[model samples]
Target: MISKFCKEVRQEIFFTWIMWGVVILGIVGVSAASGFEHTVTGAYARGSVRWLLGMDLYSEGMHGFLYLPHAAIFYSPFAVMPAWLGEPLWRVLMIGSFAYGIYALAGELEKRYVANLFTVSSLVALPMVLDSARNGQMTLLLTGLMLLATRDLLRKEYGFMTVWLVLGFALKPLIVVMFMLIGGVYARTMLRLAIGLVVMFVLPMLMASPSYVLAQYVGFIGKSSVATDPYELLYSRFCDVFGMLRAWGMPVNGELQTLVRIFVALAVWGVCYCGRRMWGHHLGACLILTFSICYLMLFNPRTEINTYSMLSVVLGIYVGWAIILNKQTIIGGCLIAFAVMIAFSYEVVHQLTPGREYWLPPLLTCVFTGYVLFLMVFDIRPVVKVDRVSPTQSDMLGVDAEKEAEGLVMTSSVS
Candidate 1:
């Protein structure tokens, strides 16, 4: 039986869904009408032309294409179109992808919870949607790909998952971290991912000369290295641990930042190892993915606020699971409250402080995400059902007898 609190949460989620739709439509309409010129999409559009003409794609400053050369091949069709046509088309595509992602993720929830999926998801995603639309960022497309990947993962469709995951990686290399982490648990998926990467790399050579492709790759590496340099003025936009330390007046050079990032990654790897058994369980897998995605966003030196769009689907899943469990622990409540605060803190802080204080929200978000990771690692336990599994079958499946007795057995079924 559903509790009163759960019912209330569902109601709130339903309303949030309606509000999210209204907000998305409003933003899209405004963007289309305003004809924003200086957008990330515009940069990609321009970079596509440069790639075709064999011009220096990375010399155009921050607006230049940071994406791999093959990405230009994909964007060329749209780039060839006039801005009047391409900008609107791009906006429409982004908005459509965002809606599709939300819908797909919502479909993954239980029947009762599904209705609130978009509503609850918007709590974490609305700001990102706004930011992505405003800046013409690729995050909405990335978010959509991630949602598709997660949905396929839940359905045990590893082939589809690999396709979406690799596509996302092609768009942004940071998602490669997710691929590597998940590969540790599912070796077969990793093999498919390697094949997919090879295909993606080869497909671009058909459009550009081999030498041109080589140069593009070299330029990508060089520019990315420069872009992520801690001493660079653009590094101020970083919101990860490295950025937080730098913001607090700590002397963090590129070398030191890279070292700290490596240490943090090792720490995450250790936590994942310790929780390795949990991967076989539904809630446990979701929690691990949540922590991993948060880690990717928080540790990557190039991360910006819009990048949080990638967390939309995972955050929704985490919240839905937490609510379904009806856990009343103080720590759980505090985590939920803290997440909500972080979600809304930007507006309040912006009003109260100057523009330079903009870093506060992302910093607090990083801290909150870290706490959530800790809770998932040490505190959260998977919900298990013993009635369906006999002792013999449990033993055969490698279920820990002691953990099973404590109601911590992994289930084969996702829901």
Candidate 2:
């Protein structure tokens, strides 16, 4: 009887639409309230292009483009096109990449409908597109790349797939490193990663910058270290780390920060170790969430709710949960309700407080920590079942878990 209902739910597309409808409405309401269009647009338009190329990078005293070289490079192509051409073109590119990512993720799960649900729901169901589009941010593109690389990794296509991920690292080193932490350190992955970095990072630098320009690039990286953006949320969150340690009266210095980073890195490593042994995508999802949240917390001192771009990755994890977790216990249901409440409740909180100066750090910390724990524990499972590979998927050079599992476990792949 339960199985029958579960199948019915799985087949129900309207339910997914309804859920997404609510998400869309919420995004619209929030954007209107936040006044994102005018503010975000004005800021980016005023940013200097020369600085972005690592020449006068951060010369005007803003981390605008210095910290994000990968985004800078990709945006360079669109930068050449007229604004009218570039903005819309970039938006379309995001949409296309998102579609590719959905195909990749669904392929990971071996379910066509499941992947379609991810593409449609994730595209329209969140504020990602609106925010990325408004700010001309590459958040969605980065997300799509991360998703695609993860899907490839799961299928054991370590070479080509990891390139997408390595490119993401070159763009925003935080989240990609997180994914690597979760994927664990395998020889094949390491080799692929090295090759990808060479292609994506080293080659790009060599081609884009002359020897003299390369020296300037090194200077820019150095300047970025001392540069602090107070308005950035991640930087503020790093302050929180200091505040937390200081409250305990521990001197929050470079050494402490380094220590905390090491610990977080280890935590990421453990999560990936488990993920490597897992059947679900939760490991990938959790690593992305943990790393993104930590990155935002540590570096983005002025990140506002609008800049919660990485949250979309966590939302992807939730969608994965909806598919994999067949059992919905009251406890689990309550937790899910809490997650939804917190994710959607920020709007309400904003209305009530209207950005008053109060314990924002603790609130963010609690929310991020809870969500990561949820993904690692409830969403990811150790055992996964994979059947015969689809022809299209096989043609894509898919890995057969059954073949990989021949001398290992029961019948399916673990790790």
Q: Write the per-residue lDDT of candidate 2 for residues 233-343, one digit (tens) a residue.
A: 232323344533433345345554556666776775666566545634434443543465555544343344434444444444444444443233453344344344434
Q: How close to the true structure is residue 213 of candidate 2, measured as C-alpha lDDT?
A: 48
Candidate 2 Cα outliers beyond 4 Å, as residue runs = 1-55, 60-62, 68-70, 112-125, 179-184, 205-209, 228-258, 274-304, 323-347, 351-415
User: What is the Cα-based lDDT of residue 397 in candidate 1?
Assistant: 40
Best by lDDT: 1
Q: Determine the C-alpha RMSD for candidate 2 after optimal superposition of all C-alphas.
A: 7.1
- List per-candidate RMSD values in Å: 5.9, 7.1
lDDT score at residue 355, model 1, on the 0-100 scale: 51
TM per candidate = 0.79, 0.66
